[model samples]
Target: MRMTISTHDHVLIIDDHELVGTSLMLSLRSEGLRADWRGNAGGEEGILADVRRLDPGLVLLDLDLGRDRDGRMLDGVHLVAPLIDAGWRVLVLSGSSDRVRIGGALADGALAWVPKNAPLPALLRSVRAAAQGRPVMAPERRQQLIDTYHEQTTARSELRARLDKLTQREREVLAELAQGHRAQAVAERFVVSLATVRTQIRAILVKLEVSSQLEAVALYRRASGR
Candidate 1:
């Protein structure tokens, strides 16, 4: 069945390629929906400005935002959470099938992901669904999300269990270390000797079942929801 697209369902396409953005914008507008295109994400401020001005119902986002000033790939995944936080519904449209990237986008609150290679009809359907606040995901992608959630939950549970075994002093040491404190600094903060701080760090690592101080600190941050 054909999905009904409302005229008020305006969409913004953020793609690094001008041709791709123009093509998508034209196609979307042809369907009687208001559509616009921006060739780059333009960073947080720029994107937020565009969102405020256009008030798009949905953003059809390309995950690769081309290169940054540093020549690194400007990952659009970083924008998903901010866009959602700012009350924009985003639908990821990417050619890359990297599960980690896809999973990150889903976890970050993107409404759906439509492969860039998908037929225009399929893309339009996904966009319509997103505009109507209906979430959709491919079965395999859905399973991946489920598995990721379960894994994070299990890890958190295990981390909590490990933390339960920590002494009060050990937890304090971990908190300091997670904040990038050196053993010497921690010793000064706690008025303990450097040796004592190092000892606490070792104990923390053992309790957390981690190999090193860094690992212990990372686990502490994750466990503490920092």
Candidate 2:
């Protein structure tokens, strides 16, 4: 059943993509709902301000907020809890298909998610449902996403613990290898003997529980979020 748009609560769209945000705002307005688009969203402060100023009942939040004027990257996962805390419902509208991030947003209290590429009508349906304080996601499906996020977090924590076991020199060698540098090049760069660099590589592999240099480099990149 299509729920009627309630008059008590407005809608706010916080997506750094200007076109998407504005289009959503305009479409919702045509549905006889009050809507606003805030493309910049600034950062945490900007988000807080928007919540306070608009006091929207539902927020369409993007998981990747892009960046601010200073080029600092902003992750929308961090904003979900705050918006929920401020008494607004959040429905994630993100381009990223990363289940971990989507689940992370849900774990942080987002009501549900709508992909950035989802049909506009479908997306708006979710927005309206959220605004009406109705469930936008099934309980089972939502729990599955949350489980995926928790599993990834556990794996990442284990990987970090292994990475922490590396000696300072081994970490340097692993970093050089990650940059596509040959062992010979790394040795020369560090003014160390080729044998010394090769030994460090072996130690890094052992500490990271990887058998090959390639695996070691891959693990380092994964842990470092590169």
* Model 2 alpha-carbon drift over 4 Å, by segment: 1-3
* Best prediction by lDDT: 2
The lDDT of each candidate is 0.80, 0.85
TM agreement with the true structure for every prediction: 0.61, 0.91
Taking the candidates one at a time, how many backbone clashes does each contain? 0, 0
- True lDDT of residue 65, candidate 2: 86
Minimal lDDT window, size 10, model 2: 1-10
Model 1 lDDT at residue 15 = 88
Tens-digit lDDT track of model 1 for 1-226: 4346788777889888899999988988877888888876456457667777666478888898887655666788888988877777888999877656666787787877789999988888888777777766766766676467567767778888989999999998888888888989999999989999888888887877889987887788787645
Q: What local lDDT does model 2 show for residue 147?
A: 99
What would the per-residue lDDT of candidate 2 be over residues 10-50, giving only the tens digit for each residue? Answer: 88888888888898888888788788888765687887776
> What does candidate 1 score on TM?
0.61
